[model samples]
Target: MDGSDQGLECLRLLNEIIADFDELLKEDRFRGIDKIKTVGSTYMAVVGLIPEYKIQPNDPNSVRRHMTALIEYVKAMRHSLQEINSHSYNNFMLRVGKSAFN
Candidate 1:
C-alpha cells in the first residue's frame, strides 16, 4: 500500500464513522434533532430546531425535555463512537459542549 492507498483508507474509515453518526439522527428518539454540519471530524447537531419540537417560553417542561433529549443524544454519540473505535481499532474521543439560548 502506497501513500494514496493509506489516505483512501483513512477517508473510508472517516466515512464509516460519519455514516454511523448520521444514522443516529434518524432514530425516533432523536426525531427533532437536525445535523447542522460537520467540521472535519466534528459532528454538529441541534435540537428543538423544528417548530413542533421548539421549546415553549412559558413551559418549563418543554425546556427540560429538550435538554434531556440533547443529553441522551450526546450519550448515544459517545456510545456510537466507542463501537466504531472497537471495529476500526482506533481510539476516538468525544468532547461535548452544550448550551441553551433564546
Candidate 2:
C-alpha cells in the first residue's frame, strides 16, 4: 500500500466513526442533542440548544435533566468508540469536555 492508499483508509475509518456518532444523535434519548460540527477527529455537540430542550431558569429538575442528557450522550459516544475499536484494528481514545453557556 502506498501513501495515497493509507490516506484513503484513514479517511474511510474516520467516516465510519463520524457516521456512528451521527446515528447516536438520531436516537429518541438523544433528541435534544445537536451535532454542531466535526473539527478533524473531534466531534462537537451541544445539549439543550433547542427551545423545547432548554433548561428552565427556576426548575432544578430541568437543569438536572439537561445535564443528565449531556452525560448520557458522552457515555454513549465512548461506548460507541469501544465498539468501533473492538471491530477494527484501530484503537481510538475519547476525551470529553463539557461546558454550559447562557
Candidate 3:
C-alpha cells in the first residue's frame, strides 16, 4: 500500500479499536479501575485512588489479593487489545505503564 493508503488503513483500525475500548470500559468487570483521561493516544487509569489504596503493606493477604487482581485486570486488558490487533490484521502494540502507591 502507498503512504496514504497505509495511513487510511491504520486510521480505520484505530477507529475499531477505540470502539472496543469504549465497550470494555463500560463493562462492570473493571469497576475498581477508573478512566482518568486519554492523553493523545494513551488511555490512563487509576486503580483505587479516590477511596484510597486497599492493599496494606503490613497485611500480606491483603497485598496478595490486590496484586492478583491487578495482574488479572492487566492480562484481560492485554488480551482484548491483542484481539483487536489480530482482527484488524494490524501489528499494533500497546505499551503499558503502571505505578502503585501505599
TM-score list, all predictions: 0.88, 0.92, 0.66
Q: What residue runs in model 1 are displaced by over 4 Å at the alpha carbon? A: 99-102
lDDT of candidate 1 over 69-89, digit per residue (tens)? 888888998999899889888
Candidate 3 wrongly placed segments (more than 4 Å):
1-5, 52-63, 100-102
lDDT at 58 for candidate 2?
95
Candidate 1 similarity to native, TM-score = 0.88
- Residues 8-89, candidate 3, lDDT per residue (tens digit)? 8777776676666656656665555666876656777666553655446689886676666556666776787899867766
Candidate 3's error at 94, in angstroms? 2.2
As a whole number from 0 to 100, the lDDT of residue 8 in candidate 3 is 87
lDDT for predicted candidate 1 compared with the true structure: 0.85
lDDT (C-alpha) at residue 82 in model 1: 96
* Backbone N/Cα/C clashes per model: 0, 0, 0
**Where is the poorest 10-residue window by lDDT in model 2?**
48-57
lDDT of 2 by residue, 1-102 (tens): 999999998898889999999999898988888899999998899887888887787999987887898899889988998998898867889888877686
Model 1 RMSD in Å is 1.5
Single out the weakest 10-residue window by summed lDDT for candidate 3: 47-56
